[model samples]
Target: MSCLTARTGRQRQRYEGHLRLVSGCIPYKFEKSVGGSNCSTEKDLLVLMISSPSRDDLVFPKGGWEDDETMSEAACREAWEEAGVKGVLGETPLGDWEFRSKSKQNSCSLQGGCRGFMFAMEVTEELDSWPEQANYGRKWLTIEEAYRACRYDWMREALKKFVTALPESRENDTIKELEERPLRPISEVEHQMPSQGCFGSHPSIQQLAA
Candidate 1:
């Protein structure tokens, strides 16, 4: 016998048989200097990791996607709510991963399973406090460190993809220029897909670079 059943009528369905859909962001930033040099260095890319509220494991900031917001918007909102950071969100998800949630009763899966869409967010500002501040602790870690510290194997793969796609190095002048430039609010930025197709139709890394 199946453990799942669809709910009828206007009451929103909570679970979808054996899986729940979720969205999240992988917040990252390029370290501005290396060994006291005033220029930026791509070798020092860092990703933000947060302490999970239910356990001591380190994980990226992510949460459920609200119906009112797009997937990208939900990822950005989760970053701000959970990590107190803000910045430009990639126009598309870098990739996705599936995991079993610890809190299974609230999820649609009989096993508490969930699938997450993960996007890359270039962090521009870090706030002193956030909504989840009391429940989570945040830290910035280098690529290798983040990979090793990640609580799940799927997250490690995502980190690897991010590292592989990053440029070997960036010009100091370009770094300085970007730093000097003011960043507009993410909401103001418009994302346009090339006539070629959506992100799924293109190379994952290339889409991220775009």
Candidate 2:
């Protein structure tokens, strides 16, 4: 069995007023294009999405932002638990959106409303199995496919921010860059990185450049 396990219950869940604080991420990576070394064009970009056990639709990995961790760490944790993948977590958030929780069983104390923060994850490692593998099946989709598959407008907006921040035309945007960095959980590295809000500095993407 995998040593990693998903967190259960919401004992450490954090909230503000009536809205629960939640964190999630759009996990993305680049595949080899026609040229090989450099990833060129939008088609090379692939974002990971996970299936919800309670719903037929797919969603990015996310959950309650526990009081013990920063929102960025919470976002990375969700991606690790739900999607079974890890990479360089962006220092900044793609954005925050207020939306209703789709599953009451999974919601925090605030009924169905949630104030969610999202970050862009540059996927560095893809595991053979994960903590929530039985609960959430993961799939990678191209940017265009992900847009159509997005069930919520906010998720789509997060994705828009991700692509805008790192368009394919940008120089030195390659899978090699992220892969060069050592792999470590966000918890271990969070101290060295800046703690950012929904709106912060230019996003630091951890990708195949992972």
Candidate 3:
């Protein structure tokens, strides 16, 4: 016989959204000023890598922050560890941004677990090379180029504001070169999907027994 008890009769509801943790690091070098003659070849600004670890898809230099470290420390450490450069982190955090990932699972807490932070900073030196274990590489790009490379709204906005404030940036003109350009939609593969209850840990339903 089918059970029709109070608990069995009602349909179960599940959390609709997944939690995520993310961060951002902005670095700029000194390469004289753009659009100026007799400018030194040395790079003036550092454009953090905008690529994803799983693929060549570009993304700003950032990653998950460990429990023991502060957001500031995470940003600085990621810059060195991912880009192979060192510098003083920005005094205040720029802000926090969000993104969804379908690959998120129990092992990836920040992916579909909780909110995340975006930290800012200024670089003190040019990186000759990244950490030995770092699989990522750094690139130097114009403010316009950097903006074009980013996909997320939050990341693009952050890069634009920071680049515009630079002494070398032009006045009156806000955007560098994003007006006429085309942007491919966020990749389907990157979109966050519903969990299959692999860990039996629903976002809202914490394990009370454990």
Give per-residue CA lDDT, model 2, range 1-210, as digits (tens): 347778888899998888889999888888865654575444467888877775656678899999999887888778878888877777767778899888664655668788988878778887767777777888787665665567677776676677766755232333234335543332231111111112232345523211
* TM-score to native of every candidate shown: 0.67, 0.73, 0.61
TM-score top scorer: 2
Q: What ranking emerges by lDDT with the best candidate at the front?
A: 2, 1, 3
Q: How well does candidate 3 match the true structure in TM-score terms?
A: 0.61
Clashes found in each candidate (C-alpha, N, C closer than 3 A): 1, 10, 16
lDDT of 1 by residue, 1-210 (tens): 122121123233234556666777778887765564665443567788887766646778877765566777667767877777887776667777778876664666467677777877777788765666777778786665565566566786666656555455333333344336553342232222111101211123334322
Query: Candidate 2 at residue 36, lDDT?
Result: 46
Error of 2 at 201 (Å): 12
Q: CA lDDT of 192 in candidate 2?
A: 12
Could you tell me the lDDT of residue 134 within candidate 1? 71
TM-score of 2: 0.73
Candidate 1, superposed: residue stretches over 4 Å from native = 1-17, 36-43, 104-109, 168-205, 208-210
Runs of candidate 2 with Cα error greater than 4 angstroms are 35-43, 104-110, 169-210
Error in Å for residue 79 of model 3:
0.8
